[model samples]
Target chain A: MTGHIYIIGMGPGYKEMMTDEAYQAMKNADVIVGYTVYIDLVKEHFPDKEFFTTPMRQEVERCKACYDFAKDGKIVAFICSGDAGVYGMAAPMYELLPEYESQNITADDITVIPGVTAAISGAAQLGAPINHDFCVISLSDLLTPWETIERRLIAAIQGDFAIAIYNPSSKKRHDYLEKACQIMLDAGTDKNRACGYVENIGREGTKTVVCTLEELKNAQVNMFTTVFVGNSKSEIIQGKLVTKRGYEI
Target chain B: MTGHIYIIGMGPGYKEMMTDEAYQAMKNADVIVGYTVYIDLVKEHFPDKEFFTTPMRQEVERCKACYDFAKDGKIVAFICSGDAGVYGMAAPMYELLPEYESQNITADDITVIPGVTAAISGAAQLGAPINHDFCVISLSDLLTPWETIERRLIAAIQGDFAIAIYNPSSKKRHDYLEKACQIMLDAGTDKNRACGYVENIGREGTKTVVCTLEELKNAQVNMFTTVFVGNSKSEIIQGKLVTKRGYEI
Candidate 1:
């Protein structure tokens, strides 16, 4: 019988923000597995527990190690930042686990504890950009086709939805944010919308900028940045950004 | 001179999950104000401080009170669950403050700290339903026109963006989710997309369900629930919900 595999979200950086349940869950684990960055994040909590750290893009092997250890009745945990389910390691591990189970390995007990993500953290930095309805899309086409991303951008603008843009740009793929804003402009008026960019959320050197859609075209953005574009109701008042709920004041 | 008001997001109901800086900032405040529920959430930490609580709908007044108190050069902190900038109390307060300041009652200083929101918490509970690019929308049209909400839904689906739906329905508006689902179906194949509904994300009595877009329409849902609709690459695998990042396995 496999002991449980607990995939926990450490949440954006700081441990104090971690839930008691998540902290206790991680503390009770026999072996903890995660990316080196995440392992470094919670290493102080479990100085004596076995630690397994993998390089970036090697989540498959890291998860297999966790599942294999858990199969032998070890309490194993795979950790990720800001909710394991949001562009983190949990789903990929879950997807690959079933294939390993056919090799006479049992895979059953698995629980995912939620954590905060960058978009919310970024939204918290900016004032209520997501107060109403919103959408989040990654501008990176590393795994997703650009064409598909373009379609989503066009649709989001047409819907007049507040949008959280993730993986906006990288060294390999520059101009994704510019293109996204261009698409939004094509769908609607550039002056009527509000946009915000939050970079290095929850970490030192974090910076946030609130501007218009046209301003986003020239904003310095990167993978660490999460961008928000407001709907028709979003506004900038006295340098404070707001997306009105359209309620009677 | 008016002391500043720091509106902080405590993240999803966990002290350990609260950012170190946000925790320190709150600890240094002279006065803290929030809804009774949020005050209760962080009660143990500020047992000796001056704290005030209000009913849910009284956010505007509560914020005003905080601002008034802060004008005495006292550091006042307003606490919000998840990120203060989301559907929390920050925006309404920001909107109301400038008007008060114009009357020569100088507005208190305001600084917003980001915290994790329910969408990430919901995603964490459901196992990576928001891994790819996604969008978040609130179904409540209390402040927004239903027509605007409808347009956003259609755009999100057309973009094939995974969407997080907040405030799905309330007492008076029970048909919002149904109508939103109908709009999604109209834009994409109901059978092709995956959706997850998570309720009471950080609190007890949390429930999560993963199903096809068609099944989501029939799922027992409510205003407390946060719904995630997967993009084209999203799928329900062996009861575990996932959205592919398109990276090589």
Candidate 2:
């Protein structure tokens, strides 16, 4: 009586960028559940699959709805824009296991199919800024406290790890990325360290900009943008950001 | 005339796991370059295409050979095991650009195509262990000093980020992973924290093991294994390791 619930990453919104594992999971799903935007991305590929969507900020509700569908013996595919494990639906789905256990649902019924994440996809467009040890932190204060985010930025800078900032800016929070960049500068990081941002990666209207930390502090960004801040060894070689692995020549 | 040199990630060593973007790049290339093991992964698919591989320690010489192919006005595809941006060929290719530029080569001739990295792909098989902020560090001290690696591990532990350890062990570095676990234990981290390792992801002989940190300290690992160590908030729920993302009711 157990049904499958696959958590799939759509991978930056291009069909070509998706892995066959994710594509096959969705293609075989009896029902599809996701945010409104993500559901639209794969609608064309599975025209006959039952689809359900919820708007932004309704993650818990959407995940619950997907669980109910799976509990009823229908194979479900839950979609996320990037890799489902990274700041995506995988955590939320795991958090909901206790609520659905009464319906005989269990974590064993779920599977996560990984895909290309924004940090790697965006880094590819801007050149290679994440060649060594790196850390990823979301700049949004919606779930995590601002103080925690600030401390992580300072620690990452001090540790000299290349950083990939997710949810860098949104409508209500305009100055968070600026404040984060300031923390790096205050940590004695070079103002000219390679910094770049990519918007709408692998989708239409995809735009990318590469600059210094000084310039990125005031650059225009939105929720769609993912930022990359290079480490001390990162440099611009032939007009592209590249961080060497320190291999002895 | 300058020809294209595409830096591609083969994505965990399976045709089904690779993105269409990377596949097409290699399919259209006049010559392909990679390490011997990775080159063998796609050799059957491209029997007609010319391929060149270098043994383990000759990365520089291998990259030089790739540049030579592209500089001679032939399209070349340089393959990396995981995403090219993460501890892959993108940085080395960029570093070699100067040496190739003396042959009238330039950065404009190169393009990076991203794919699923080991951290993400490996996490998928083990459940959602990287559902929050995380850092990735390679334990191998071949290129990077062990002292620097130790410092980053401590910082990542203190920051409470989920950690992905790449190149966890090799022939000469058998005890490196054990040493890293001891640092986490000394930092007062829970000795029973959930940890797991995945080997040969998406290919033959794929194996995964999940256990507590204390067990991981003595676990057998090799260069092909990618390790995941959970943070303070991660736990085992229904036999799956999951890091909850503070969802509000």
Residues A1-249 of candidate 1: C-alpha lDDT, one tens digit per residue: 557888887767767656555677889998888999888978988889999898977777887887788768888888887777777777777687677676544324777776667767777667677776677777877677889888888877777767778888899878888888888888765754788888887777889888988898889898789898887778876665677665445
Candidate 1's TM-score: 0.87
lDDT of 2 at B159: 82
- How many pairs of residues in model 1 come into backbone collision? 19
Q: What is the C-alpha RMSD of each candidate to the true structure, in Å?
A: 3.2, 1.5
All models: lDDT? 0.77, 0.89
Among residues 3 or more apart in sequence or in different chains, the pairs in candidate 2 whose N, CA or C atoms overlap within 3 Å are: none
**In TM-score terms, which candidate is top?**
2
TM-score of 2: 0.97
Interface RMSD of each: 2.7, 1.2
Angstrom error at residue B198, model 2? 1.7
DockQ of each: 0.52, 0.75
Top candidate on DockQ is 2
Displacement of the residue A153 alpha carbon in candidate 1, Å: 1.1
